[model samples]
Target: MAEFTVNPLRFDPYKNFKFRLKWDGRYVAGISKVSALKRTTQVVKFREGGDPTISRKSPGLNDYDALVLERGVTHDLAFEAWAAKVWQIGVAPGSEISLADFRKDVILDFFNEAGQLAISYKIYRAWVSEYQVLPDLDANANAVAIQHIKLENEGWERDTSVNEPTEPSFNSTSA
Candidate 1:
């Protein structure tokens, strides 16, 4: 097991709203939501002939869940460009997909209340599996047009190098 440094000053957990996503060495604009990072391991069961009543279970393959990123529809082509790399329409046969650059590593950075970087996660070999250009349009409803992308990643790990930040202190003296 890995060791982690605890923050004594912090009693409350970090908020979910303070996070940013980055890919291709640059931050994507206006990413308002990101799904949780989850992984599951397959269990292998085996039992001896003598002990047929009891089954021994062991860990097998690891499966990483796909991450969904959501944001309001805008002119930013970052999401569209990456999604197109997986599959593009109206291109010459065999050249429609960008095989070399389709997969990308992304970083998810979490910030503290003071806008300081507190923690980060690195997602490996992620590629866009699903892309929604726009959500259901409703004239009567007042809501932002949201677009989303589902990224299939091989795996993800927390970046331990990003240590807990020290909370700032504000001291005032009467003049």
Candidate 2:
């Protein structure tokens, strides 16, 4: 135990809004939300002298669920184009759709209050799995239409080498 110094407490929970979403190192659009990964495990049992009461916890596979992103639809056709290529919709009959056309690495960045890079999760080999357009048109409600897109990735790795880097901004509407 050293002398009592000022304890730099960095314990405040980060706000959910200060996050940015990027696809292939470029900010495709303003994203509203990104889902988290769900981890699961399997148990193995062994036969004992009396009964099979002893069990061992084995390292199970990491389940990367569909990451959902909510953003406002823009005039750009990138999303539509990606969707078309992903599902092989309206493509040339003889043309071959390779993995490069659909899969892209995504980066989800979380920032601190001082507008600095706090954490980043690099999602590997991601592709747009699903897209939905649920627009609720109303005259009284002045709300921006939010489009949702679901992406499935192979895995994600956290990057921690950044410090006080420029914070990327997403759409204003945050949950």
Candidate 3:
């Protein structure tokens, strides 16, 4: 029989609920959902002149998808204040707009069962791309109103450091 080798696993399976969503520096509240960071590549193909069976393949641009987050509507309209800078630029009268006042970084952290920081992604140049409010008026059903926000960023990098938060965290394995 051939020798079988196994690769060492460094991390245990982490929970989903034990996560943090921080924009710039402070943690963004009222967040109920978030999206996973994803990357996709384009395939370019070229045919050789001499041989019909010969073909060349090359990689193209890298595309990153926007992160979607939703939360229960709260009295604190802090997100609106920040989003106005990005959305209300054309309507509001102003000279040269300052990007520093609009664009901000976002960090998504995932924790393990022990409430320790396991994996994180640092989203770069994140800004409010789209915002929507869906209010359902029903006489029989009772549920909290939820607000959705889509964040578009230039790129993101996965963080493998041991930088843990100083506050309480949770762990949920529920799907």
Candidate 4:
């Protein structure tokens, strides 16, 4: 069976440049970069008592890598707010951390070249583990100030509900 039923003619894979991150029911602005989603499972090896030479392997715990989101420095307080939930420097005794609503589920949406929604993935229980307010300043170098946040997520799965969209074609006639 063909993988892309809607766009069967598409031979090239989707590009990584067009993507958006959404949380708190709204899209996050200035998300320039996002780390790859990766997961690994530990392999458990065991040897039978009778068959000493042979070893069997089984799947163990699964570990999901932390996701890093980067964007140009702006006045937005979304990143700072989320990071503060995990740990804050100044606050009353133990009220620094927002334990009640720290973790959040974020949606990553990938768009096609025509700005159509192509795919999406739902990150489960993601919480900010690290936050970078500003990048190193250089007097001679010309670059945008980038801020980033590292999110520790329990797991993530592709949003199967978002299927391959029917690509649009524009027809132009000569004047």
Candidate 5:
């Protein structure tokens, strides 16, 4: 039987990511994307006969279809699939990637440009939960806080903590 291998993957903002293989020198012929929500089974099917293709199509979801078909140019996959596309592009140095870094980079590189303010945080949390990357919120929270702090240093701050109080409006008390 030919060797079949798959490993953790990611995509960077500059369109670089990697898919690791189990074998010592198994080169990737190509890669594909599928949505986790559509798959009923956890098993991933590898194309037989020394081919490197992932076969699993996500079901038709309204939001997913809208994103894919936007502007009459199909994005080719849902957001998760887009994440996989990032992962596919990362298949170059053959090293394991930090999911946290992936989240942050994807945010700074792609999401931020799209005018999505919370996409980074939302997607980061989802990836962390799904991949079991960080066991506790403390770790991820620290990382996110660092990101925010850096942004603040760079003059980009958004008040989200709700710790800051708003000035009370003063109207005529006895009017």
Candidate 6:
């Protein structure tokens, strides 16, 4: 198996920050951090030589599986890590228009279109530093977001039950 890592990319005023992909072959593409990890990693297989008509094979799914097996994590967690990394970028604003800002907008758009409402809403709230209602998109985001929320809620319930005291029987007469 070939090892692929992302080098910290420079802050570009005009273009998105680009990570250097050092795999078996040198394939460089400037990807937004989230796209780099989530989408790109999955379909970016093979260093060089594939037709555009075909999709790139990526280690993303493999990595997700590895993480699930190794750490017993959900795919949402794994993909979120990739998405978070993609969203983290240095910004330099030239005349109030920043590439980092543009990348963030694109990520939000993708997140919305990809049916990641909960995640997207959370990110927006955190970034904006406010508590606001999240916009409801189509069923796509609703499905994925509900899945994530359900998993998270289940995990919380499991942990809470584990820590809670069991019910005890009491005598009929209590002083």
lDDT to native, each model: 0.95, 0.71, 0.75, 0.93, 0.24, 0.24
**lDDT of candidate 2 at residue 155, scale 0 to 100:** 83
Q: Per-residue error at 86 for model 3, in Å? A: 1.3
RMSD of 5: 23.2
Give per-model CA RMSD: 1.5, 7.8, 7.7, 2.0, 23.2, 21.0
Global lDDT of model 2: 0.71
In the range 53-86, model 5's lDDT, one tens digit per residue, is 6555444422211001111112222323323422
Candidate 4 structure quality by residue, lDDT tens digits, 54-145: 89999999999999999999998999989999889878888879989999999999999989999999999999988999999999989999
Model 6, 44-125: lDDT tens per residue? 5554455656555655432211001111123424323323333333544333332343222112212122222112111111
Deviation from native of the Cα of residue 114 in model 5, angstroms: 22
For candidate 6, the TM-score is 0.14
Q: Per-residue alpha-carbon lDDT of model 3 for 1-175, expressed as tens digits?
A: 3332322443344567878898757888878789878888888899989979978999988888998888888876757776776756456466334466778888888876667676688899877878776667677878888887788888998774544434434687988
Spell out the clash pairs found in candidate 4.
none
Candidate 2 C-alpha error for residue 5, in Å? 17
Better of 1 and 3 by lDDT: 1
Clash pairs for candidate 1: none
Best by lDDT: 1
Q: Which stretches of candidate 6 lie over 4 Å from their true place?
A: 1-133, 137-164, 168-175
TM-score to native of every candidate shown: 0.95, 0.75, 0.76, 0.95, 0.16, 0.14
User: How accurate locally is residue 73 in candidate 5, as Cα lDDT from 0 to 100?
Assistant: 18
The TM-score of predicted model 5 comes to 0.16
By TM-score, the better pick of 4 and 5 is 4
| lDDT at residue 132 of model 2 (Cα atoms) | 74
